[model samples]
Target: MPRALLLTLAALLSACSPRVLSAEGWSFRIGDAAGEVRLVSRQEFGVCSPKLVGCTVPLGHGCLVMLDRDYFLNGTPRQRTLLLAHEVGHCLDASVLEYGHGGIGAQGAVYGEYYRPAVEGFAESYARAYVAVCGDNLAPLGYGSGPACALPDPRTVRVSLP
Candidate 1:
């Protein structure tokens, strides 16, 4: 999408806040029809937005997701889906809303890795578990290679963001 249209869409997005689900792992889904997400696809430096590929805003019970279309456009199909999944991870992951200071998921850095296990780390782990089901191959956003690519027994897997 063009930058103009992307910005227009951003402006046209609902003013209401996002309604995210507060479930563990990939147990819950964030419905599109419910307007639980407000996507803003625009020009960005990689998934390098302030929040990287995207950001999730917590709304108490749950939270809303705001996306950077750049990731969707620039990333591979696998990367795109993983990006959305990553955002979903942010919405449902408690560590992000509370500890990461309102879901600053991998904002320009890796999270959930052994070195930096934190809020964003949990969210990336959520996305990582998702790709693992597909097979052994790793697919990180844009870079096309993920970390660990497996979810732990208690769903506390840690792998750095792409």
Candidate 2:
């Protein structure tokens, strides 16, 4: 192949390749749908938005979870996995509501107080469940002192879809 063609092919192949993360007998891949979610989140939040330091944005079929380079470099493997799993939970519709938003007064109160917490709780529960199931494998990864290992009761998680 011509040099230019070879370079172009390489770029194309790279673009088509899925983003993958693997550890402790668990592996995850972000496909095209998830890539779109990440693009949207990057556009909306920009790089390292303080507000989105540790947040998840759910798209229709997927979600974008932010984990700054600092966290990836400094956090324990367990923390990294827990964060990813929590966001994955959101992508998988673990929350009662499809999205979180509300106005003031009674409805707003529900949206602000109840809705957001329910979703967060659900996501945390999902992460915790994963940790519980894989505790033996994940323990060495430094998940010893986090919410991932000590998850809340799923029954307590309220869900009011809108």
Mark the regions of model 1 whose C-alpha exceeds 4 Å error after superposition.
1-35, 42-51, 95-117, 134-162
On the 0 to 100 scale, the lDDT of residue 156 in model 1 is 45
In candidate 2, stretches whose alpha carbon ends up further than 4 angstroms from where it belongs are 1-44, 47-52, 94-116, 136-162
Please, what are the lDDT tens digits per residue for candidate 2 over residues 1-162? 233543343344334322312111222222222311121222233323554434454444444444444554466767766665556555444223444311112332333453245455466555555556554333322323333344323333332332
Clashing pairs in 2: 103-108
Question: Local distance difference test, per candidate?
Answer: 0.45, 0.40
TM-scores for candidates 1 onward, in order: 0.47, 0.43
Q: Give the top-scoring candidate (TM-score).
A: 1
Cα distance off (Å), candidate 2, residue 44:
9.0
